[model samples]
Target chain A: MKAVLPDDLCKIFSKAGSSGSWHKYLKVGDWLVLLLSCALVVSSYTLLWRGGVADRAIVKRDGQTIIEISLNSARKTRVEGPLGTTVIEVQPGRARVFSDPGPRQYCVQQGWLTRAGAVAICAPNHITLELNGRGEASYDSLGY
Target chain B: MTPSGIELPITEDDRRIARYTAAAIALTVAEAALPSPLPGIKPGLANIIVLVVLLRYGWRDAAWVSLLRVVAGSLVIGQLFAPGFFLALAGAVSSLAALFLAVQLPRRWFGAVTISLLAAFAHIGGQLLLARLWLVPHDGVFYLAPLFATAALIFGTINGLIAARLIRQVETI
Candidate 1:
C-alpha cells in the first residue's frame, strides 16, 4: 500500500531538511540552570523536612484564629464568611475546604492541606486555613 | 504554511509571533481543562512554544509571545483581571526574564532543556512570591516550594524535549 502523507507534513518535509543536532545547542548556561534548579529542589525539600509534620489545622477568618482542629479526628464544619458560607472538612492527617463562597472557588480547588505549613485561602471570604506542625513556629513575629 | 501561496503583507517576524502565540494559548487553554493534583502544579506544555521561539527567533520575540500567551490565555480561560491572572502574569514575566538571562550565555553550551528548567524555576518562584505577598501573606505558603520545584524540574525537561523535537522539525521545514 502506498503511504499517504498530510498536505502540511508533505510541504514541511519538502521545504527544508533537518540539519543541526541538539548537542550543538548545549552550552554552559544549560549546566548552570540544571545545577541551580537541583539545588533549589534539594534546599526546598530540606526545609520541608525540617518543618516536620502538622498535627493540627488552624482555621482563620479576618486574620484571627477562629478554630483549631486536630488531625487525629475526622469532622466537617461550616463557617460563615463575608461572602457566604465555607465548609471545611478534616480527614485523617489532612484538611480541605469542601465548599467555599468565593466566586472562583480557589480554596475548594486547593484540594487538601496535608503537609506542615500548607494553607488554603478564600481571599474574598477573608478566610484562611493553615496546617500547623507540632514543632515550634517556623517564623517569628510578623512585620520585620 | 497557509493554504494559499500568496504571502500576506505581515512581516515574517510578525507572522512567527502570531503563530507561536496562538500555539501557546491553545496549549494553555487545553491544560486548563485537565484536573491538576495540586492547585498550582501544571505540566506547563505551553512553555515549549516559548522555548522554541527563543531558540528560533530571539529573546524579544519569545518575550512577546510569552506575555501574549499569558494575557490572551487568561482572557480565553475567563481568568482575566483575577488573582490567578496576576499570578500568571507574574510567572510569565519572571520566566521570560530568566530565559532572557539564560540566552545571554554562549549559545553552544546550552539547549532548550536548560532554558526550560531555568524558566520553570523562575516561574514558580515568581508565583510563590506573589502568592506570599498578595494572596496568602503567610510564610507557610513557602512550604509548598519543594513540591512545586520538583514538578518544575520534571515538566521542564518534558517540555524542553518536546520543544527540541519541534524546533528540529521546524528547521527541516
Candidate 2:
C-alpha cells in the first residue's frame, strides 16, 4: 500500500497551494495592510502637495532676514532699508510689498505672492521679500 | 604552525546566510542597472529576496543577508562608502526593523505580501528622513514624499505578490 494523506486532510493542504495564489497569500491582516497603504498613498497628495498657500514671508534688508511674518493673520510691517521705509502687507494667504521708497517700485508692483518660493525684490532699497512654505514649491525656481 | 591553510569552522546557518546574501547582492546590482526617472525611486526588487530569507530562516539571519547585500552591492557598483551606500544602508536597516515588527503578527494572516509591503514603506521612509536631515536639510526633500510613497505602493504591491509566490514555492519544497 502506498502511504498518502487522507483525502479530506489533503484537500485542506492543497487549497492553500501556489496556483490561484493571490487568494491564498492575501490573508486578513494582509488585506487590511493593503487597504491602509492605499489610503495612505492617496492622502499623501493632499498633505504634501498643498503648495499654493505659503505659510510665512521673510523680509530681508540688505541680505539679512529681519522679519519672518506668519501669513495667517492680516498685518502690515514697515522695514527701513537703504532707500527708505518699505511697507509689506500680509493677508491670510498672501504677502506683497505694499509700498517702497525705491526709485523703481518693482517689488510693490509685483503684487501678492500667494505661492511658496515666490519672491519680490526692492533692489533700489536693498530689501528683498519672499514666501516660504512647508509644502512643495510651485515653480522650479522663483523670482525674476 | 606552518604554511598549512587554517580552516575556519563554518556552520550550516553561516553557509545558508552566505548563499542568500549572494542572491540578494546580485539582485541589487541588477536592479541598479535599471534607470530611475527620479533620483531615489527604484522597484526595490531585492526586497523580495530579503523577505524570503526572513520568512524561511529568521529575522537575525535575514538581517545579515540584507545588510551584506547593501555593502556588497555598493562595492560592486563602485559606490562603497559613498553617500549612496549610506542611503542604501539606512533603507536596509529600517526595512529590517519593520520586518522584525512584522513577524510578531500571526503568520496565518500576515504572510510574505504584508511583510514585504511594510518593509518597502519603511525603506523609503528611512531614506527620505535621512535625506531631509543630512543631505538637503530642507522641507523640500519631503516634497517628493507623495512620489516616493506612490512608488512604494505600486512596487511594494508587485514585489509583495512575487514574494508571496516564492514563499509558497519554498514552503511546498
The candidate that wins on lDDT is 2
Compare the candidates by TM-score and give the number of the best one: 2
Compared with the true structure, what per-residue lDDT tens digits does model 2 show for residues A33-117?
9999999998998876776568999999878999999999999999998768999999998999999998878888999998888
Clash totals, every prediction: 8, 0
lDDT of each: 0.83, 0.83
TM-scores of chain B alone in all candidate structures, in the order given: 0.91, 0.95
TM per candidate comes to 0.62, 0.70
Question: Tens digit of lDDT per residue, candidate 2, span B1-173?
Answer: 57658788899788777777776777888989999998788998888878877887789998998998999989999999999999999999999999999988899777777888899899999999998899888777777899999999888888888778776665565
Candidate 2 lDDT for residue A5? 28
> What interface RMSD do all candidates show, one decimal each?
5.6, 8.9
Off by over 4 Å in 2: A1-23, A55-114, A120-144, B1-5
Among all windows of 10 consecutive residues in model 1 chain B, the one with the lowest summed lDDT is B164-173
Which docking class does model 2 fall in?
acceptable
Fnat for each model: 0.54, 0.59
